[model samples]
Target: MKVGVVTFPGSLDDVDAARAARLAGHDAVSLWHGDHDLKGVDAVVLPGGFSYGDYLRCGAISRFAPVMSEVLTAAQGGMPVLGICNGFQILCESHLLPGALIRNDHRKFGCLDQRVRVENTSTPWTSSYAQGQELTIVLKNGEGAYVADEVTLDRLEGEGRVVVRYVGNPNGSLRDIAGVTNERGNVVGLMPHPEHAVEDLTGPGTDGIGFFTSLLESAATA
Candidate 1:
């Protein structure tokens, strides 16, 4: 499988994400923000970082990048897309996923080994995880709080769109939501850094390997 990792001007984790994809037995491709093509990648990852220096709200500017047009269309066509941290912010800004990520409720950047419950295992990026499984991954961000109105929040809960929930209230998210999937289940966004956990020797653990492996398995089956 070929997985494309997008790199914006300030993207910090694209290299790690590509490495993680390779470790999961995929051909990793590097995609630039200004590129108009996906390079025929089977899947795409929007890695974390302070895109556009987070000047106009985390991913606000990065959402308008040329590559997102292709990503949005491909995602709608059932191509798997995973967004992490600032990438999650971009997904929300692009309207690929609902809700928004604001600053932490405590009004500070947060960094920790976060425990997250897998609420939906049917998505391409999450199929390796069993529903209700709890895994610890690194979470770090200045704006990681997830927010939505009551109606949307309730609807997400009702429809099982909430893909991952924090084990503890780490960022003051409603119901401690850490990740969510689009209605079609092809697109997912999470605040934690799964790529950072793909290597046991250097990372917190290899628990995050499931994410990349799940996508590869899904692609093979498809």
Candidate 2:
């Protein structure tokens, strides 16, 4: 699969994200924030970073990036799209996924290997993981708390759209939510840096490979 990782002006993890995709046996393509095309990639990854310098709000201005328009259209047509960290904020702002990410309750920036449980094994991003499996993924951010209304929260839980849950609620995300998927299961917004966990040599473990590999399997079937 050819996976595209979008790079905004302030994006810091686009390179790492591309490497993660290559590590998973996929061709990694670079997509620009101002570009209006996807460059024919099979999947898209909105890598973690303070896009547009996190001005106004995290991912606020990025939701209108020219490239995002292409992404939004592709995602709506059932293309696999994964948003990590700041990218998660962009997804929510773009209305491709529900809920919003706000400042952490601790009122401090944090960086750690977070433990999250795989809550939904059916999404394109989690099919490679076993149900209830726990993964240690790199998480770093100051505004990483996920928030949504009670009704939206209930629907996500009842519909099995909650993709992953933080083991310790480190960021005070409602219901300990770490990641979520759209109704059709093609779009996923995760507040952790899974791409940073793909290499055992550079990261905590190989637990994050499942995410990228899962895309291949899903695309093959789709």
Candidate 3:
């Protein structure tokens, strides 16, 4: 499988995401934010970064990138897309996913090893894990709190679209949400950095590999 990792200005983790994909036994493709083409990748990953220096808002500027337009169309058509950290903010800005990421209730930048529970495994991005699996993924962001209207939040929970929840509520995200999946389960937006934990030599453990492997497994099954 070939996974495309999009790189926007100031993006910090695009290479890490690509490395994780290659480590998972697949080809990693580099995609530029200015380019409209995806290079025919099977899946796409919007890695973490402060696009446009978080000018207007986190990922607010990146939401209008040329590559993002292609990503939006592909994601709507069922292509799997994973957004991590700042990328998650972009996904919300693009309206491919719901809700918004806001400043931490403490009004501070947070960085730590956060534990998150996998709530929905039906998505291709998470199909390799069992339900309720907990992972200690890296979490670092200034504005990572996820917020949505009560009705929308209730709907997400009701439809089982809340793909991951914080085990310890580190960022004060509403209802402890750490990640979420789209209605079709093809697009996912996560604040924690799973790519940082994909290798035992560098990260917490190899638990993060499943996020990448799951994509390959899901495609094979389909």
Candidate 4:
């Protein structure tokens, strides 16, 4: 399967995401934020970065990009989509996922290796992992706190949409939510940078490779 990684104006991890996709045995396609075309890829990944300089909000400006318009459409049609860090924020802004990412409770940027546990392995992007699997991945952002109304949170929890949760609650995210998936389980948005952790040479370890692998397996079975 071919996976397209979008590069927004300030995207910092688009290349890394593409590399991870390729390493996971899939074709990696480079996608531009200004392009309305998806290049006919099997899946899409919205990588981390301070898109559009994070002017109004972390992902507010980038959510209006031409590519995101297509992304939103494709995601609704069951094309697998994964969002990391700022990409997660854009997913929320685009209404592809629920809740919003806010400033860290500490009022400062956070950069560290965060430990998160997989709460659901049924999502397309997490099918390769076992439930309750723990992973240490890179986490860097200022606005990483996930917030949602109590009712919505309850619905997500009740429906098993909460895909992952921080093991130690690094950013004060509500209920320690580190990640979530859409109703169809095809779209996943998370705060951790799994792409960065796919290589042991440069990253903390290879614990993050399962995300890409899971997508590949899902595409094969689709």
lDDT of 3 at 41: 96
Stretch of 10 with least lDDT, candidate 1: 213-222
After superposition on all CA atoms, how large is the RMSD of candidate 1? 0.8
Q: Positional deviation of 73 in candidate 2, in angstroms?
A: 0.5
Per-residue lDDT of candidate 4, residues 68-164 (tens digit): 9999999999999999999999999999999999999999999999999999998779989999999999999899999999999999999999998
lDDT of 2 by residue, 1-222 (tens): 999999998998999999989988899999999998999998899999999999999999999999999999999999899999998999999999999999999999999999999999898888899999999999999999999999999999999999999999998999999999999999999998989899889998988889999987777776
The whole-model C-alpha lDDT of candidate 1 against the native structure comes to 0.94
RMSD of each: 0.8, 0.7, 0.6, 0.7
Model 3 bad stretches (over 4 Å): none
Q: For residues 44-84, what per-residue lDDT tens digits would candidate 1 score against the true structure?
A: 99999999999989999999999999999999999999999
Sliding window of 10 residues with minimal summed lDDT for model 3 = 199-208
Q: Model 1: what TM-score?
A: 0.98
User: What is the alpha-carbon lDDT of model 3 when measured against the actual structure?
Assistant: 0.94
TM-score of 3: 0.99
Any idea how many clashes model 2 has? 0
